[model samples]
Target: MKTDNSNIDDLREVLHWIRNLVTGRLKIHFSQIDDYLVENIAFSEETTGLASFAITHQPTFIEFAVLALSYVPHIQPDFFNKIIAEYLPDGGDFPEFGCVKGTNHRGILPTGETAQFIIAGDDIGKRIAVQRLFSSEHWFAKEHVLWLEQVREGEPAMSGRMIMNPEIVELLTLGTVSKPSFSIDFPAEHIETEMDWDDLVLPETTFRQIQEIEQWIACNETLINDWGMKKRIKPGYRALFYGPPGTGKTLTAMLLGKQTGNEVFRIDLSRVISKYIGETEKNLARLFDKAENKNWILFFDEADALFGKRTDIRDAHDKYANQEVAYLLQRVENYNGLVILASNQRSNIDNAFSRRFQNIIPFPMPRPEERLSIWKKTIPQQLPLDMDLDIENIALRYELSGAAILNIIQYCSIQLLADTAPFLTAEMLDAAVRREYIKEGRIT
Candidate 1:
């Protein structure tokens, strides 16, 4: 059966058939298999063809079977178990994959050995599947595949645990492949927010930078294909969004993700730092490994965790911390996708990290015009505004960040709703602003 471009079921059918084909090897001939399966392999029931994404670009059923077998335990581990099942009484044949001599366990890469096996029938039907697969472009490089395969074998390298990219994991298990992007793992217990571009309220310079970011994202694929570039050209697509808290650095990141059709993963350094040495690097490695090959944007909030001035070697901790920073530099430089670092203060970022970034757009607090926009957009409608509520006057009265303006608007909406007020008066808004000031610790 040929499958559609992404014929998941057809893909499964090919693998299952291959599974049975390999299993039949236990017996001297394919005829020994169940009649139902035997007949299916015999020209099958009007084979349906599918277009597969195999490296060879061949969509034949045999090509799909080859791909299914090559990925090994990385995909359909259960199926591999069945294909390699030991129906034979045992003559030193591994029960896991029933190959007597040459068999690939499908780790990061093949063991650089041919996985030769007999394909049923007579002695002349010997074949080497690994030899063919090694000649193709695996989903991951052999080294990376080997690393993962080793890690799975319970002998993870000192580099700590790395994992298959999420997209790969989903493809193997769920039969679905997603566009490349980053999303937070709920188990990680990190709070991040995403918003549309329209939702962001920022000063003109900041908005211009966001537009530039959008343009950069649009040109990303062209930069690779047209520029003869595997990595980015000089002035890489990295950015530093520095601003006071609530000036929309985080919001801009979400907007960028939405605009670019990529998943943006926000990492909070405050939550990521660990007291244990090497744990931080392990976590960061895991993050990078997961993001690799996936079209994703890494948004690091409170990046001073990695960018802090290297302290004089006061102790071993200091030395390791510097190593962590160095590791970050290398990863970011090599990362083929986008990386955005946000900080409350530009001065807080280390010169070393900041120097490498291509864009360093500072977010300034909203001015009166932007504040007016924020008030108009955030304030809910149908709340009776006391004819006395003057939006222009409120915007003029307080020099507020977009965040602070939203907070006051929220308070005003709640107060009006709670009191069943017919109109939201200037007095109520003024009171809300007062509460915001107090909340900011401006007064007791």
Candidate 2:
């Protein structure tokens, strides 16, 4: 990544401010710390890079200090150590500094207590006020900027390590935020496609329903905010896409995001659902928290695994399962952007959840004409076809989904390439169709 010069200069100024504050506090004591902060901290409307973020958010002096302090270890690992060493020349423990050693990094890492110490120092009332910066009400926590890490039970909340959001860190350093990789912490995979709306073949009714979703994405912000309907209307748009596996449900989601210039993420249910009680909710919470305010379309493929029919309270396990559904339903409803839940059948999802959706779209098996369109669009025009091979007849004869037709075409293309055949023959297409039928457990 190319480093921005403005970002480097801004960060350098922040480092200089931090050094002066630390050294001044050590010499003049905590009484004069506020003066140091007030004199040093400033914001500019025209600033670029990380300073631009500060300008947009307009963070308070102490809040900006905490944010910058949390970022210091990432850029300058030995920042606090050098400051502490200057004050404590003997190199002994400085408990008042409120820092801990990282497992791998051989430098002092700042924690919530460090922020409190820097901004509040010995003033108990000031320290109490500083704690609010880490609270849920703060924009930092609400926006997923930076937060105090959770510590073990019974420990002081201030003692927990400060963690800056990795995406925010990247944006500050590299001047662009990259897509997050799928991991245990983030169970959603970024999904996109190069295919356009023209490539999709669907029934007119289904296509019209999809257009409604597109309209919602286009005009939702205007409806909610600009039109002053936020108080009366719900925050997000929820939709259910029900169809068989080979239908175009997933592809439609990718196209929606593509057309809207928003990212689409498919939640991995295997990684999300946990056998242990409460673990499932925790996993989902992490996913939702990261996705909050991101304007992402979250696609829950095979959503029945998490949003299935809630059973009667037959046992403790059943009770917990129902609770998980309720929690998921709440999150989906509250999400500000689009939430699409896909299932093979709408009946698989809980009726309670279904009642909450703004739209329920059925992606029924494509008709013979639609299948024919898919067949014609998918095949390469340059590839020679046998004069006797009737694509229209094949489309009419076989009941296939768009995805199934693509699979058959892919198979035929590979065979033609491998054999260096002059033309794609009827026999080759028939063989590929047979393979698809066998895979689907249908008699051929």
lDDT of each: 0.61, 0.87
Report the Cα lDDT for residue 80, model 1. 41
lDDT tens digits, residue span 10-61, model 2:
7777788877766666665534343544365542324556766766788777
Candidate 1, superposed: residue stretches over 4 Å from native: 1-8, 20-52, 55-67, 70-87, 90-139, 142-148, 151-166, 177-199, 229-236
* Winning candidate number (TM-score): 2
Candidate 1, 172-224: lDDT as tens digits: 44445644333332212222355556667776777887788788878867877
In model 2, state the lDDT of residue 46: 43
Distance from true location, Cα of 67 in model 2, Å:
0.8
Candidate with the greatest lDDT versus the true structure:
2
